[model samples]
Target: MASEGSTPQQLSDDFTDLQKKLQVVIEARQRLDAQLSENQAVQKEFAELDDDANIYKLIGPTLIKQDKDEAVMNVDKRLDFIDKEIKRIEAQIAEYSENSEKKKAEIMRLQMEQQQQQQQQQQGPA
Candidate 1:
């Protein structure tokens, strides 16, 4: 629904707008991926620790002691949330990509038609 315009200029504008949106979605997906990786690393570290091992979290430049089980649970929740966000963004990216492709094809078709019209005009009375 984002790229319904049919005019050459309108189609070009829609394509540009979709590209910008795609870039933003990609950036967001990248950030979510980084967070997911970090959370997974933390989970791995937790797995390697003893049940009685001390766990600390940095809070505003201060080391705050946190229960290992609670920390693991929090990290698990964060990973799940990040995964969902990534999936949502990926869907948006796919939609935007499809729409952009359509707009590009329309623009090319319009250009070719214009060229054909010009050729016909030049050959007038011949």
Candidate 2:
């Protein structure tokens, strides 16, 4: 047979664990957002450099123009990789948020059940 108060303790533990998981997910999302912002700044700078390099190609000497063209190509490749990484992180954040919300609802339901059980027990024979 089940004990009288064990259910409440179990529900409390489950709620705590759910809260901790949500906190971790929120921190991870913040870190990803910060990384995305930094990558965007770098991408913008790379774009500006690419534009300047293209302009130099039209008027500068042959060797200088070739070097600038190569640099722009490398920056373009790096920007493409960053874009892919940002998309992956965004997808992960969406998944984590969804899971966290579900867990929160479960915890709430468990707590309510525990409360109802306690009330029913209190109303029974002493």
- lDDT against the true structure, each candidate: 0.89, 0.61
Task: Count residue pairs with overlapping backbones in model 1.
Answer: 0
Q: Which stretches of candidate 2 lie over 4 Å from their true place?
A: 1-66
RMSD vs true structure, all candidates: 1.9, 8.1
lDDT per residue (tens digit) for residues 1-126 in model 1 = 434446777777888999999999999999998898889999999999999999999999999999989999999999989989998999999999999898788888889999999999999967
Off by over 4 Å in 1: 1-5
The lDDT leader among the candidates is 1
Which candidate tops TM-score?
1
- lDDT against true structure, model 2: 0.61
Query: What TM-score would each prediction reach against the true structure?
Result: 0.92, 0.55
